[model samples]
Target: MNDDVRNIVLGMAAAGLSAALGWLARTCLWNRRLRRKQAFFGLPDNSESVLVVNRDAGSPDLAVHRYDVFALLELSALIKECGANADVITQDAARQGFGERTEFCVGGPGSNRRMAAHMRAMLPGMRVNVDSEPGPDRLAFQIGSERYRLEKGVGEYVVLARLTTGQPGRARPVFLFCGQTAITNQAAARYLYRHHERLARKHGNSTFVLLLKVVNSQAYGPDVTELVADVTRAAQAPLPTTAPARSSHRAP
Candidate 1:
């Protein structure tokens, strides 16, 4: 009887040990997958994120434009979803060292020079031009053969791009949301935040660029925005031997 009781106790201990090890293994595997999914959206858990906003010193009364504020809010919400926090900074405060961490640069070349520099380096084919005359509808963006113009009653265009600068294991990703006008900027930010999961599933840890069209510009904010094109594959393709000259014609 004593031998039988000892044998039964040993069997129960072995079973409990096996169950605990299985549970631990499953938990570790699940956590690894969750981290990979989060990284696919450029938001790794426990990582630092920065949202660079354009600062208009010319308009001292208004430190940051309303459109930039809207973009900041959208990005902040997304960062929170990633189980991390982001620090919001002005364009003037942004510097080179930021490339080491994940960053979201909001606004256009005319507004955020840092974003413009990165755009020129990472996306040589895309261009954002501002009319010298400066009118209500003088801003335009061009990508490949497609050109988008801002019209008072029609709508505006914005570019949302994700880029990296290192090898697969050590790459630093940056998200750029820019537009010729403030309304377009807001639209792009909203689109990225709303469709991040879908985009992550499609891109799967790759760099991508998207052009979004904001319809009913005169109406409600980003609610009317739509996807115009997915230029990721094209933008990532190697550029031609000779770069094409910038177009000067204003969009009709």
Candidate 2:
């Protein structure tokens, strides 16, 4: 073949490969989302007491979390479906040594903007709250139906449910959901956490353990019934306290 023709053919092949890879990646992500959704709504198992934790490291704050990002997205959708109130907060809110913290900061618009950008990156096409001239001491984002304010901070993935009574870290039957990279196996407990030891150590909010199956270690979207079973088993376990804590936080 002529040199130009050969080059053209190679370019076409590369483009085709790129397109295939993109499609495969998208499909994997979508399938994972669907599975988590099924678990969230009890579609497959008809269980309502399941708690989900999501883990992802693409945050603008780069928090250390437990589950995968995709799982969290699905968990959010699930919470809305169940008509339950859910909120995301910084892991620092769970820090032991920190005397006090503010949910909304008076002088942290820039941080809010960065957090918004991170959310946009993680969840494209979803409506985000980005205040250009936000009021002083404003929060960054809200999750689920209740519009509870969410702040970005260090650590792993967790969706804190607000308790009527004011208590810190007292949520019960806490279900952690996380979105793991199919290839990386880098969920909250995996190797991805090594990078954020400083933030995790600084705050005590990084103590979340998640369970997910390696769907694509060889073949993508394999059965997660066992993983789901594991989650159910964990949910069946008794929680430390029944009274939910007022400290709503998130780390993924």
Residue 36 deviation, candidate 2, in Å? 19
lDDT of every predicted structure (CA atoms): 0.75, 0.32
Model 2 lDDT tens row, 199-249 = 233322322332333332333232221121112222223433343333433
Candidate 2 — number of clashing residue pairs? 27
Kindly list the per-residue Cα lDDT of model 1 for residues 1-252, writing each as its tens digit.
699999999999999999999999999998875676578655677777888898652475537888778888988887887788788888878875635778889888877888878877788777666555765435676666555666644677788888876556575688888876777787888888777768878876678899877777776777788777888765555445564454432223
Candidate 2 weakest ten by summed lDDT: 98-107
User: lDDT (0-100) at residue 74 of candidate 2?
Assistant: 46
TM-score between model 2 and native: 0.25
- TM-score per candidate, chains pooled: 0.76, 0.25
List where candidate 1 sits over 4 angstroms from the true fold: 1-37, 56-62, 135-137, 233-252
